[model samples]
Each structure stands twice: as structure tokens, then as C-alpha cells.
Target: MHDAASALNPQALAEAAGAAMYARDTASQSLGMKLIEIRPGYARMTMPVRADMLNGHLTCHGGFIFALADSAFAFACNSHNLNTVGAGCTIDYLAPGRQDDLLTAEAVEQALAGKTGIYDVTVKNQDGRLIATFRGKSHRVSGEVAPVQR
Candidate 1:
């Protein structure tokens, strides 16, 4: 069960099913985000900054970077097909990202306590240099699937 794919919880969620898939799917049209990988309690995704994503400083917006890691965080937290919600999160930007650069976000769960889980997300550039780091807390809601959008 520790196999890479198994560790990613692939059997529990198809590449096109569930909340992770949905978030990643919606990200394509909405956020222009692309999910790269998913393993048990882990997830990775990437995005190309658009002109609109730039901030007053003309680089990728800080909120956009946070969104990148947050998406991965949500995916990792819900890989078990359980409904979950973000209870809180904090992020630190170590560097800025540009519109022409490819940004990668990676999230890994740090701890789990029945219905509560903690995750750490890191964002890096194509060269693998750190751009940002995030810590997130999630609460597993009682349900067979992730929360539905009404």
C-alpha cells in the first residue's frame, strides 16, 4: 500500500473524479492551473502567470501564489474522498514570481488527528528554488465526499 500510486490514493480517486479532480479541473478554466501529481496526503500543481496575475510590482501576485499552494493543500487533504474544509492557513513569500515563469506548488500532510489534519505547502520555480511556503489546517467533515458547491 506504500506504492507510489497507492501512496497517492489513486484507487480512492480517479484522475477525473472527486473534489481534487474538480478543483484541478476548475482551476484550468478559472485559474489556468494544472495539477501535476497526487499521492496519499501529497499533491503538486503548476500554473503560468497571466498579465492579470501580476501585481502593482508587475510580478505574479502574492495572492496568486497562495492560491497555488492552497489548491494543492486542498487536494492533499481530501485525497481520502472525505469532505474537508480549510480551518486556517499562513504563507510566507521568500521570493517573487514573474508572468513568464512557471510556478510549481507542492503540498504534504504533516499530521492527522481523526477529523483534523495539518499540511505544509511549498512553491518553487522550474529551477526548484523555493518561492513560498505555507502551513494549513483542515477539518474533515462527516460525509462520503467532499463538500458540494451549491
Candidate 2:
């Protein structure tokens, strides 16, 4: 399964991967998440904390923040076009996200071995306040993101 799709250069692979995933990512799109940056084993995305995203406490719900982090993790782990899925993940909230705030999540690969990998995601608000920290474990499945020269 170590094919050209997996062997593509970092930038090219990131482009291809994002193109493939973004086309089918209705969840991220519907949430108004935007891809800011992407590279091999790395991705950054932003989501706006809309009024509807606020909870009873008048802060953005943790689930929305988690989704932003998870989305970044998904992109980072799948940057190689290896078709990865989350095996497990955990997130810690550090600060509250307020309405009208733009939240950005950046994910970076921490390690990779065999079919499993680890990624760390940091969520922040527009004011440079840390909102959450997330760790994701990924399992690669058999597939190609797009056609690639051998």
C-alpha cells in the first residue's frame, strides 16, 4: 500500500488530500470552518463562534471547539493520502470561546508508527487566547486519496 499517493511530495500531497477531503466534508463546511494552511503532517483551520454555537453559559459549546480540533487532526493525519481515521482522541478546555470570536485550530503530527499515528491540536481564539488542547490517535486504512504517478 506504500504507493505514489503516499509518496507524493509534501506540498503536492497536502493539496491533493485537501481537495479530496474538502469536497466531501459537509460537516466542516456546514460549520463554516475554513482551511487556512495545510502541509504534510500539519493543518490549520478556523471556525467562527456564532451566536448559535453558544451554550447556556453564554460561551461556545465545547463540542464545537472539539470539532474544530478534530477537523484539523483529520487533515493532518490524512495529508499523506493514506486514508486515516481517528482511533481515539481527547481534548482539554483551557478557556472559554465567546460569541463572535474566531477560533483557529492547528494540528501537528507528533509520531507515526506502522498503521498508527499521533497528532496534537491547539485551539485558540482571535485574541490569541488558548481555548483547548487536543490529542488524536489515528489508524491508517488502505486507500488512495487520488491518482498519483508510480
Worst 10 residues of 1 by lDDT: 11-20
lDDT of 2 by residue, 1-150 (tens): 236765457788787888788888999999999988889899999999999999999999999999999999999999988899999999999999999999999999999999999999999999899999999999999997755666
Error in Å for residue 22 of model 2:
0.9
- The residue pairs that clash in candidate 2, if any, are none
Give per-model TM-scores. Answer: 0.82, 0.93
User: Roughly what TM-score does model 2 have, to 2 decimal places?
Assistant: 0.93
**Residue-wise lDDT of candidate 1 within 12-119, one digit each (tens)?**
453323434655456554877876787668888888888989999998999999989898898788776677789999999999898778889988989989899999
| Prediction 1 global C-alpha lDDT | 0.78
Top-TM-score candidate index: 2
Query: What's every prediction's RMSD, in angstroms?
Result: 5.5, 3.0
Report, for all candidates in order, the number of backbone clashes. Answer: 3, 0
Q: Pick the candidate with the highest lDDT.
A: 2
